[model samples]
Target: MASSCIGKTWCSSARVGLSLSSCVASVAGKRNRFAALLQREQGGRKVSVSSSVRSQSDPIGGIQEGLVCKPSVVTGVPSELARSRRRAGRTSQYRFIMAQAASADGAAGVDSSATFPTVGFLGLGIMGEAMARNLVKAGYDVTVWNRTASKCASLATEGAKVGLLPRDVTEACDITFAMLADPTGALSVACGEHGAVKGLGPGKGYVDISTVDGVTAMKINEAVKATGGEFLEAPVSGSKKPAEDGTLIFMTAGDKALYERASPALDVMGKARFFLGEVGKGAAMKLVVNMVMGSMMASFSEGLALGDKIGLDANTLLEVISLGAINTPMYTLKGPAMVKGQYTPAFPLKHQQKDLRLALALGEEVVQPLPVAAAANEVYKLARAAGLGDADFSAVLETVKSHSRGSTSNDH
Candidate 1:
């Protein structure tokens, strides 16, 4: 096993049919493949050095930058031994190799094992910033980039490096995580002239944790795959509070191998994870859950409105509902908020509306009818129509109330 390093990031490349333990060893020592090669030149040939090149274990014949070398042979080497091999002076081969090592992390090639790879986080909004903080707190070397550079100020003090552009992020980190507003926002930073895709290659991984539709996710997946980077769709449930608390549930889908590689990071950002098969499953699951939530909120609205007209105290009604078989955490969380008229955005109306819209499209694709979900979608549409798109989705009750007063049509 051989471990290589590019800058501070560790990259491991392993040859086929070799034990992974061996690859883990090659890249584990302080003296990386390049450093070992340099030492051999100064040791006057008694070192009997193995292949000085980074291993090409990838089936595609080459490894990418920031990936540790997975050596064909796996043997433990002591760090003290690596540190003691300092030979200074006149080997042209040593100079040539140092030049190669200097630019290895910058190019799309195999990496060294001496350092931890940097992680680049894009979007520092409510969710993005929290996710980045968790990564930093978990001990990942992190770099951040946000459209509003001011958004990154808080994280910079937490030992996070801030960069100016998405391309800079790619150049700095081995893996990049994106938590943007939607597909448009994700694509804006991921594709085009100065986007991340330009810097992505075989050694890079891009995880999109945004809530885009399955189709949009597929398009993004295609874009990332075309650039030789691994892509994963990891839409999440819960909102800003869950994100901050690190309890967001990830509905992930993509290459299972890549998912395994990222499980450590995902575990840091979320409490639970569900690998739902392909690229679209995570998006599909998010849409399904949101559709149910939207519809349930709509139903709860009607129930509460009727209870109101019948002279029931909304608070007591909520207490009763909370005790009954109909109780749900969603009810508990939103009931008091609704009762107090505190409809601040946790999950904004526009995003919920987007989820419903995507669910409706998915339903159409599968030829499945979702009348209740359809009805809920209509309520959200009405909420948006009422200029409440930026409010919490619970504000849909306003539309329900207005409709109850015979102010509008519910016809589809």
Candidate 2:
């Protein structure tokens, strides 16, 4: 592997067949120079290095900043290394190369092994557990904690160290990520007694990937920064399956340097990431996305109910919709299950309602009229009232069907 530091960003190129461990061993003596390159001074203070470079597209304009590890030209290698590459697969080799390069730069305080940053994850709920697992799978030294300690058992079995409290996780790790269910939970984990913030200091960073209001996110940012720790609010855009599959989209804001540092882990857990600038933008963007999704789900439920009432097969309606301009993965994935009255909770109805409530409040704060979203919020409330709170958000169809029944009976 060959590497260079450019403007606080480290770029590395690896020969196609070279093993990452062998490459790291080859450059073991150059650790001091690599460390010096990162410690370059600007004025009297040390310059903060970004682990990634800005893409040709602007991140401030909402495009994803390109991550580090630009691909290097592949060269022919010895037969043994070529066989190794073929055995390990190119994707794994490249990922290993990038991981090693990032570690060797020491921008994120990787250990002497030059392997991975110590990662702490708090809140192992449905989404959180899956995300933490992905990081562990990607070879990070991960510590996990959850409110219900039993939730940590599965991860412990998977080689993640379990923490007794949020502070313990933060104190022991270089970077801590929280994915609580709400702003309240987020605050409680980060700012409550013995919270994550209590363990933070210089060289430690906290990233909250929880769904929260801008105000709440800003509050967490303040608490984290007060501890001399960096903060990033990175609320994701996909639900349980995406979280499990590591294909979620991250809408991130606050602490650009930390974002760059967290890039490798983020890449492990998400397919795309957008740095939207400032502390609350990510929360706002996530709320807006969820608001749109809630409204769409409500409308789709009504459409299905209306079709069934008019003697059209719900499946047929779904098929027609799938073939149309408005087709989306949500509809394609949820429609058939919804038609069968099987809502298995990929994204729970209660959380959808919560996001809708938060989005409506955001609109109210900005004095923007969201009449459609208001209607959808009411529909979700009805679903929750019908004891479908724990069901998939697609269970909103039952409320739509219930409303249809009331209308039909009123005609009698």
Candidate 3:
């Protein structure tokens, strides 16, 4: 298996609000009706902030009445960008976010002294919705936004108020978490012309929990820093089940101070969290892990096909693999399904291919030879061409099996 890094990018400048007015910084500007919370405490007062600020002394203004936010504003990004982020395997806590911000204003600053962290959720899809549900279930005050209006329905049933736009989500909560589908979508929501970037100021923090390459993460980091909002790239490993179980593992990289402030929320969503350093490392590490996974799946597919060529019992082959030194939890979980021809997608084929593509891209940058991964990438391509893009990645076995002379005969 070969490990690799992915693409290039130009950088630029990209919160959640708090429940308590004390947890929030209030400011009044003649031209701008706006406020920003300090990233840290100063004399026990929430730091006040401003946008489009070049120096430390810039002042924030007020909100304009009747500003219309696009549907994407509430869902973490615009609908088109959000759709792009959602390829196949990746799921987001987008749904929960939807319900929270379904109403114009979230439950009026839930009794500050006893209020839990008010969360501003950007992106309200499958995983995003589930995670938000858990937070609501845990009694956390959550505000949500999504690209589409319809997605907010489930969450609204849970007593969540939907936001009119993305900025509203930030204004309604203390801290905001972004569970977008990809870097573009995450960035779109955070830095678009009327995106979250425009809404953030100091004292607010943005956590990006999407699986994009390092370059994208760095771009986001720069944007957040420019606006005085702290940024962290905290991508996760493990698929939908792990997210639902709250046992996902976080690969985080950012300022240590921001990490401390975000840890409690991260802890609620994931079982393990690693502070990888800087902004891009977490994304970098995730690519490496997926590279190995792509290679492993390809190798297993070859092995299973070869075994069948010699008349080996499918059950026996799986059992033997499970007991061998090469045994891995991934194989154990997917192998039986491969043998049984059940490829109901836990992780989709197209997404597996995307990860492999990302891994190979990284390999090119690092000058690492990955003949195995390269070959696997081809196989994944074939799987995609065969119209199995939406199928489970375990379906990789089908390609090998169907192509082999003996296995094809057995299929009939």
The 0-to-1 C-alpha lDDT of every candidate, in the order given, reads 0.68, 0.75, 0.62
Please write out the lDDT profile of model 2 over residues 174-207, one tens digit for every residue.
8899999888999999999989999999778899
Model 1 CA lDDT for position 342: 75
Q: Give the per-residue Cα lDDT of candidate 1 at 48.
A: 25
Q: Backbone collision count in every prediction?
A: 32, 0, 56
TM for candidate 3 is 0.69
Q: Write the per-residue lDDT of candidate 1 for residues 255-278, one digit (tens) a residue.
A: 665675565466557767788999
Off by over 4 Å in 2: 6-95, 98-114, 409-412
- Candidate 1 achieves a global lDDT of 0.68
lDDT measured at residue 29 in model 3 versus the true structure, 0 to 100: 23
Show model 1 residue runs off by greater than 4 Å: 1-116, 406-412
lDDT of 3 by residue, 1-412 (tens): 0000000001111112222232122211211111111111122244322222211110111011121121111121101112212321111222111122222122343222221346777787657777776665444567778899778788888867787677787666656788887667878887787677666777667888877888888888898789887888888887767777666788989976667555546655766678988888888898888778888998998999899888899888888888889999898888888888898876678878987887788888899988888999999998899888888888988887767853445585
Query: By the lDDT metric, which is better: model 1 or model 3?
Result: 1
- Listed in order, each prediction's TM-score against the native is 0.71, 0.78, 0.69
